[model samples]
Target chain A: MSTKITNKEQVEAFLESYDTFLFDCDGVLWSGTHLLPHVVETIELLRSRGKRLIFVTNNSTKSRKAYTGKFAKFGITVSENEIFGSAYSSAVYLSKVLNFPKDKKVLVVGEKGIEEELESVGINYIGGTDPAYNVEATDASLASLARDESIGAVLCGLDLHLNYYKISKALLQIQDPNCHFLATNIDSTFPSAGRLLPGAGTIVGTLITSSGRTPVALGKPSDEMMNCVKEAYHLDPSKTCMVGDRLNTDMKFGEKGGLGTFMVLTGVDKEETILGTNPLVTPKFYADRLGLLYELLQNN
Target chain B: MSTKITNKEQVEAFLESYDTFLFDCDGVLWSGTHLLPHVVETIELLRSRGKRLIFVTNNSTKSRKAYTGKFAKFGITVSENEIFGSAYSSAVYLSKVLNFPKDKKVLVVGEKGIEEELESVGINYIGGTDPAYNVEATDASLASLARDESIGAVLCGLDLHLNYYKISKALLQIQDPNCHFLATNIDSTFPSAGRLLPGAGTIVGTLITSSGRTPVALGKPSDEMMNCVKEAYHLDPSKTCMVGDRLNTDMKFGEKGGLGTFMVLTGVDKEETILGTNPLVTPKFYADRLGLLYELLQNN
Candidate 1:
């Protein structure tokens, strides 16, 4: 059974249980631009107590550096190293882990974030933010549709400019079993302006079905992203606590990584979801919101 | 065992077995623009013998009327009623089988074919071929994204102008469990311009993943389409033969509908795929090509 933290002692004990905190950004720190109450103060309290913080977000629309700006906008002083957006993690996984070929380029089905992260890692890429691919496909236009032999991998992420032309070209390339099929994250939907929009998984889903192939998703709940973080920081999973709102991604990620899990009821999932029968991933501790930890400690 | 038709006796015996022949278009009639050699002659031979012909295609890009124009282009006289494209079948299924509410509209993630078929049946629709939905999605633009309550069903088919905006809106609408999620057909890839391009299944796949809902597919291999054809044509399954290229859609469709299955080796699957152990579906007869029916009769 998951314990619901209410008293000041419980909050203090929860804080003391882990030295490092991995937070899922969207629903935890802020929900569609409006920062949750006591978010900044709570992070500040965690930092003041000499705890390490890493922002883990499945939203591949923004790179690590771009997310730093988003953090600054909320009055949070988060460095580039602290932010692990799927885009950055994917780039790292491709270059560092997979040892992507030097002569080959990665075909992107995403926005500037994936492109930016790929460039930052000194990896050549195409498709994302490419004006040539922005046009609507016609039978005549697709007449010359062929695989680009230079493309070694097809990396799919959330793309606002997603079109048939990009995916059609992607399908041709990935059909070669030798070519790697990668997804930044498979999050079905992401909250946008208080509304949920189709996420990267939706974009990847098209290719998955058409190609009769599955892609290697390097995001939450996948040990790839966890390893990317663990290797970068050399942190002990047993001493790390994953604090997030979603059970499938955040809580499951923590549970799979052997990290302590703290569920906050301020995002996609709620309290009953954790306590209900057949819960997706039950957290060790649950609270009304992330701010409750700060509130309990400050009050008593 | 599948009988490989060769001589006059096998050809004549095959012809005498079935009065009505269901032919899968794309691979059977023509492969992309250039019609396969002796296709017209083969159809002429079937017509000469007083055999009924029904052109059934999973390619939802064209309506029955549009397909007639294509048939005319190839010197084949095929009326709209004799054509059963997935788009038209889906439209018929929605109106007749489901008895779709007259007050509601279908949100389409396809091309003019679906819109034309829906309009033919006097079913109101939005999204398909709509210039408004053709634009690329943006965070600012998707902020107001909400479900159109009037949309009772989301019918997905092959859409060349597929964009994130169309699917994002589709996900929001289908999120409502009351809304019917439908796919015209789930053919993975269609041979286009000597290349395989992502088909209708790819477009529907995005919503399937994001919405976490399975759509009611109305196409080949589906009993729904078979029932629609059976009710309309009043054909005897025992006297009908499904002649097509693909095993999964064509052979399985015929087998399930209690029709004789005849495999032609001009489309997606080759001879080895069918004769191979653990074949997806087995056909009652196999031929090198559809034109062999005419060739064997003419030469012998």
Candidate 2:
């Protein structure tokens, strides 16, 4: 059973319970371009009380550097190290955790963000946003595509230009058991421009079905992402709280990592989901919205 | 236990047992563009014996009409009605089984073959091979994509030009619980041009993940397809035998339909697969290749 925080005392107690806070951006803080009410003030309030804040997102379309600009638009100050997008986390997972071969290159099935992050981590890669893959696959063109044995890993993320040509090449490379199949995240849908669009998981699902192989997902609800963030920030799970909207990804991620979880109703899940008889996951604490904590703290 | 058809007596007994033969064309009759050894003679022998022949393939890339031309290329006589492609089966399934509304249209996430089959069935459709979906998905363009209430179903097949634009449109229409989600076939991989390429299942998998909905697959191994062919030809399951190269699809299709199954080692599966302790689907009879039956029948 999960507790529903209602009053000012509950909010204060919740805030005092955790020294570090991990936040999910898209639904909790904002939905696409517009920021949610009291989000900026809530962050300011957390900052004033000396709470450590880290922005963690499963969106792999943007790199950490690009994400800084998104925060800047919302009048929020965020450094690269303060944020952890799936693209950057995947890069870290490859370099630090897997210790990917220095010589072998990664075949990217994504966009510029994955490429930028891989480059930042000193990893060699090809095929992401490449002009050659943009063209339609022809018999002549497909025959020209032989397996590149040099590719040690296939990293997939959210790609706007996903085509059969890319998937065909990915299938050939992933046929080798020696080659690693990796996905930045397996988010089924991403809220973008006020609509739920197909996320990275949809793109990765194509390869999985075709290749008959499962990938090592390196995002939310996976231990790889939690371990990467924990090691980098040196945060204590006992004192850290994960605040997000989605139950499957955000709440499950927090529970799996042994951290306190707080759920908000602004995103994919509703109150009925948690209050339902058979909920997918249970959060330690939940509120109508993230802004409620800030509203309750207002000097009334 | 399956009986391995070895001598002339066994081959003669096999031929005498079945009045109808359902053949999977891709790996059985031919590999790619070239006819397999003795395939012509075997079909000719079957015809001379007054056996009913039907070429049933899970490949949805080509319609039955197009398949007739391929047979003509190999100097074999085949009519349109003698063939059953997944593309045509899906159309029939939608019209006869589901009784899709005449006013409603289908949103295609496939190729021209599906379009041609849908047209043959007098089903109105949009999207497949449409220039509108051939472009990249941008915020400006996607914002213009409002749900079309008239689309009653979303059909998926093997599409070489599959793009994010088409998928985004599919996710929107499929979100309406009233709209049906249909797939021509869910073949994971298809051998093409001397290589195994991703199949219709891979394309449908993308929509399945994003929409979080399973489609009513109207192809091999599904009772929908078996019923369609069985009713069309008025063939008895006991007198019919399914001849093919794959176990999971071809063999399973035969077993589930209560028809005799013959496994040929010319394609996906091998003797070891069936001879193994836990075979996916065991055929009633096995042969090294389909050509062996023709060779055995030639002798005294």
Candidate 3:
């Protein structure tokens, strides 16, 4: 797993391998409220190198128009096709793998992102329940789909008010061995109120905790959506190096599925990760942000 | 489960009837730092009411003397005898029960608090391997007793470094069923870096996740230490109201166990709770702090 970087020079020498790059949005480009300094330049530098680029974020809370608006405000110029989020990934995956029945009805257990994805794929969705709070069954209550095992798969995503009851229902449905447990992402927590708030990951963890089985992850680190990326682009994996700050999505996407992983210290990994935890899974090359990639290429 | 309140008084009225009050400390008092202002006064008022009070915290990190000193500074007075930390609870249960197979020794999964408790109970202990971050089985790594079937039990407490290897060892010693799987407490997480640090509750949750069995909780909500309080004070439960902030421990202790639960807002329960949640399993009477209790009683 060690992508041998004999030195900084060797890593710089091998920059021309990938024709396309996939970047993660959250930890790579910006955290919740701030963008990395070199984010805009990073994309331009890659484009100048004759490389295709896409910003893939698993967060479904924001739509493409919203993301585009946000990125434009950050002075990053990109086309609508350049941004691929989990909502698109889920929609694309479902479109290919198992065509929902003509009258497909899904009990939505997530937020707006999930609802839109299912709708695009020709599945009818039960309006998601309000965010649960103040109940023991909040976990169970969140997975409204679990009440009816007839639902083929429970599409998992972020739920703010996760509790035991929703977890109980999801676990119960999964125990039937007939139901599929598809989680949007397994990020343990997300930043909220300037404090880490329990995200889809914690709820997914609880479901797995109760069911004793890992979910079929729809977002990052799972190959479930990579096929969509390939099909959408009509491109080969060998020509792409995933570049992002988040390990679970971008880095894992690159490393696990046979692409180069470039970790920028800018976003998700944080200052704490400068000293790597899993060295084998470490980035092939890192820069302060995308702007430095241009300077390195020029020096080479 | 409603204690007959003839007047317009609330849950505190029932709690005031108890002669000997048991409290769960961690979530009930302070989440670790920043003492709730009324905590000292609440306990003082209870004492003034001739209530025999005990401070029972499930956290096994600190010793009895340590807590007694800390509380003294906050203006609440208590001796080492009045505190029952999970560390102390674990020791009491072991000494009275299996006794760790005499000379065979036992591995300790906790910190100095655990060591002190064991020594006080005449039980010998040693540190375990890798000293996992799992919060439970913190003592499972005890190299002195890990492979030894002669070791009667793997005594677990609040070790933050608990992990998978420890769980494997417990299963490895499955032939010796009497070799107990004792846990000090089942707190899901502790407050750390202002985020949820996985607690012994997560560790035990993992065990029940892996093995599908519940380990006997030896802390405040458990019958073991409550019996310890009963034995020590010769107290009557019907007259006892357990005042605490955390719902699962302090509140549940009084409510489910046939004691009136007084939930003070000063601890773990939220101000949003007054809006509605299970206030029965919550506190019968709610107060901003212990002072409110004093004011209510003093004015009456």
Candidate 4:
């Protein structure tokens, strides 16, 4: 049976048990643009309790700087260093972990966020947000497409500007045995404004099928992202707790990282999913909403 | 043991057995812009033998009319009626088999070939080479994307002009439970000019992942395309032979359709693939090249 962190004592004890709190933003903190009530207060309370706050999000469309701005808009102050978006994580993994060559550039099939992250990491890249690559290809142009030996990697994300020209270029680039394939995340759907849209996985999925190659995905639920987070923050998994609304990405991520998990009923999953038999992921604690923690803090 | 027809008597006997012949163009008849030697003469010889020759190809980028032009360019005469390109097959299946409602439109994610085929079949369609759908989506424009209730189906093919707008529109249109999802083909690669390029499967794959739905694929190796061919040509499977270079697509297609299969070594597959133990597909006959039959016709 999972412990329900409802009362002041339960919430206080839960907070005391963990020194670090990793949060998934979209569902637990807010749903779309509407902020979930008391989330700001709860986050403040965690900070006041000396909890190391790290915002871990699978949304690869935004860079860490962009997330900081979003946080500022929500009246919560957060620095770029505190945000670990999939885009930023991917850039870090490529630059630091893989030691990507300085002479070669990454072929990006994503948005500005990915480009920004790659730039921040001092990695040269091509294709993302380029007007030249965002157009339809004709037979004449296709024949004229020259292979660039400088493209050492193909990085993919959710690109609203996805076109055959970009896909074809990436396909051609990745055919080289030396070129690496990487993806930000494979979340099948993007939850926005209370609706599901096609996510980065759709783009990556097509590349996987076309190239007959599986990319190293850097995001939640992937051990690679967890490794990046652990190395960057020097996090002790035993002292960390993952708080999120989703079971698949957040809860699975926490479990895989050997951290305590808390599930909130404000996102993709419901209480029935937790209570159901043969659950894919079981959270250590369950809360009605993130706001419940704020009430516990106040009452305590 | 598979007999290799190297001489005149064996080729004459093989040709005389099958009344109808299905050929895969890229490998058997030609390789890219350069037509294989003796292919034209062999085709003419088959025509003289009164064999019903059908050019069945998974290349959805070109319409039957375009194929007729290509055949003419290769110094061979073929009519649109004798061509069964995946684009034409899909259109025929949608119009003749499904009896699609005349009032609703098909949301197409493909090239002008698919559009032309749909037009020939009198099926109304949106998207495809539409200039409006060939660009990126903005946050403001994404909000403005509205559902078209008149869309009854989503057809995917080899779309060189693929954009997020088209994919998003198709995703929205297919959300209607009444809408059908169809694909021209799921060929992973297109062999052109001695190289492999991304095929229609890559386009359909992304849509499948995004929509969480599998489309009814109409192409080689799929029973749906076989049914369309059967209905249109009134083929007697027992007296028909499917000849091509690939074992998986062509031989499997022939075997599945209850027709005799002939493997040619001039395309994607080699003799080693056919001679190997536990082959995925077993063809009834094996030839070094399509031109072997031409030599037999001249010698006999």
Per-model DockQ: 0.83, 0.82, 0.03, 0.75
Worst 10 residues of 4 chain A by lDDT: A138-147
Give the Cα RMSD of candidate 2: 1.4
lDDT of 1 by residue, A1-300 (tens): 898999999988998899999999888999888999998999999999999999998888888998899999988899999998889899999999999998999999999999999999999998999998887797766876788899999999998898888899999999999999999999888888767778888899889988999898989978899999898899899999999998999999999999999999999898879978999888999888898888888883
Tell how far residue B232 is off in model 1, in angstroms.
Answer: 1.1
Query: In candidate 3 chain B, what residue range of length 10 has the lowest lDDT sum?
Result: B133-142
Interface RMSD of each: 1.0, 0.9, 14.7, 1.2
Ranking by lDDT: 2, 1, 4, 3
Q: Can you write out model 2's per-residue Cα lDDT over B1-300, one digit (the tens) per residue?
A: 999998889988999899999999878888888888998888898899999999998877788999899899987898999999889999998889889889999999998889999999999899999898888888777788889999999999889989988899999999999999999999888887777889899999999999989999988988889999998899899999999998889999999999999999888898999999989888999998888888997788
lDDT at position B229, candidate 3 = 62
2 or 3, which is superior by TM-score? 2
CAPRI class of candidate 1: high
lDDT of 1 by residue, B1-300 (tens): 899998888999999999999999888888888898899999999999999999998778788998899999988998989999889899999999889999999999998889999999989898998899887687666766788899999999989998888888999999899999999988778888778888888888888889889888889988888988888899899999999888889999999999999998888899899889999888999998989888898773
Error of 2 at B137 (Å): 1.1
* lDDT tens readout by residue for model 2, A1-300: 988988899999999999999999988998788888898888989999999999998888889999999999988898898999899999999999889998899999999889999999999999999998887988877788889988999999999989899999999999888899999999888887777889999999998999889999989988999999999899899999999998999999999999999999888899999999988889999998888888998856
Off by over 4 Å in 4: none
Clashes of 2: 0
TM agreement with the true structure for every prediction: 0.98, 0.97, 0.50, 0.97
How do the candidates rank by DockQ, highest first?
Answer: 1, 2, 4, 3
Highest lDDT scorer = 2
Write model 4 residue lDDT over A30-125, tens digit each, in one string.
898888989888888888888899999988878999989898888888889999999999999999989999999999999999999999999999
